[model samples]
Target: MARMLGCSSSYLHKKMKSIQISARKRFTPISDANLEEHVRRLHNQFPRSGSEMMRAYLHAEGIVVQRRRVRETLNRIDPAAAAQRWSQTVARRMYHVPFPNSLWHIDGHMRLIRWGFVTHAGIDGNTRLITYINCSTNNKALTVLSYLFGPPVGTGYPPESDRTTEGRILLWLF
Candidate 1:
């Protein structure tokens, strides 16, 4: 049979098993009217809730419902609300750099400043390479300048432009 069907024997066996299993299973259809009433009640209580939240609320109320059904019901009942919720999602911005050494991103991370350590790092935007990185006791102008200048000064190749956060020290140095 597998040779005639041009498929592996294991694949044919798996397909036959799945068909038999499905044939033995009985499916009970859910009434849309009853489910829609429950969904409407929940939606009235929480107008801002999405499909996943509606499913959770239904589960809490001892009503088991699928997420897709909840979404379809919600969309039919309130298209405007669904559209508003969809629009609330944030869009990602694309980052583009022409060439390596054209632009360098520099930043000072103060996450460890409470423990008396500050981190400064730089990366070539185009190649995504770590040009320089250092941790120091203070994020002073000199320390930041040294971090920015160390790699270029050593290699005798500086970036065309340096991008950094709007810090007073960085602004003053520029």
Candidate 2:
């Protein structure tokens, strides 16, 4: 056969050895009983864990399992939970702003606060344009209010809505 294929017998033998070694290394599916029990227990305990997380949990517990098999087991054991998880993964909230000035997002970034700088910025929700941006030493109510009012006063129009989670600053605005 090696002579017919124009290769040395030694090379053919080496190839055959390599093929056998790879066949040994290939994953063989284990019985699902132990895996399903672990998956069910972990799923019951965590409830919100996805297949990858369940696999990680199993790996941490010294049990090896495939993600697809975990998901299949989860679907079989708890169909409603599986469907809910699928829906949550697929569902997305749509963010829509009618016009450039219809909504403005105001936020203060404190990442640089260790260096005594806070970045206050506003962006137009629809256009994603930076309407106002300022780096100040403080994020006090006065400073944040200035950021909120400065641009609109300059442009002679206020946005219909200003979205911010800073409660104190929001109180000052209203």
Candidate 3:
């Protein structure tokens, strides 16, 4: 090999040693058949590394080459850009139930009506049931009681005469 390169054996060996590479090392620039292949693999693996890192890897493996030369070699062999791309996809599944009353979500919303606070209540869509609703004049004990018990079955909306006994009882209970 030294004679082929037009140098004495000792001089070639000395040169190799000065570069920290053994003359018998398997990797080389244009020879040994697999050098380009190895560099190609490295280029694919470290797509984002600058030329310096590739040079360092080769240097650490005892291959003798300048950092600039290594970068040029890599560019000539692998024409792809240094930047690499990646992505992720996510999917959400819908939930369905077979029957009504299987689930019910209740909530309260307050609105200002003619007299005072009115609470609006409702069930979630999954239940498929109309929400029970009512408007109240006041949130005081008496007003809430009347809304719930409904004017004692049929006292005709509580005449002034009938207002005292039953209404007073319901208000006291609350």
Candidate maximizing TM-score: 2
lDDT of 3 by residue, 103-164 (tens): 33333344575547576332324545543445655445455444534423332221211133
The TM-scores of all predictions, comma-separated, are: 0.47, 0.52, 0.27
Cα deviation at 169, candidate 2, in Å, is: 3.8
Error of 2 at 12 (Å): 54
lDDT of 1 by residue, 1-174 (tens): 789999998888799897874433332246678778888998999999998999889888777766788888889889999999999988989989988777777788999999999998877878888888899999787887776666755433343555444234455655
Candidate 2 error regions (>4 Å): 1-49, 52-90, 152-157, 167-174
Pitting candidate 2 against candidate 3, the one with the higher TM-score is 2
Worst 10 residues of 3 by lDDT: 153-162
Model 2 per-residue lDDT tens digits across residues 88-126: 876568999887677667788999999999998877788
Clash list (residue pairs), candidate 1 = none
Off by over 4 Å in 1: 1-91, 152-163, 166-174
Candidate 2, residue 36: how far the Cα is off, in Å? 9.0
Residue runs of model 3 more than 4 Å from their true location after superposition = 1-34, 82-174
In terms of lDDT, model 3 sits at: 0.52
Sort the candidates on lDDT, descending order: 1, 2, 3
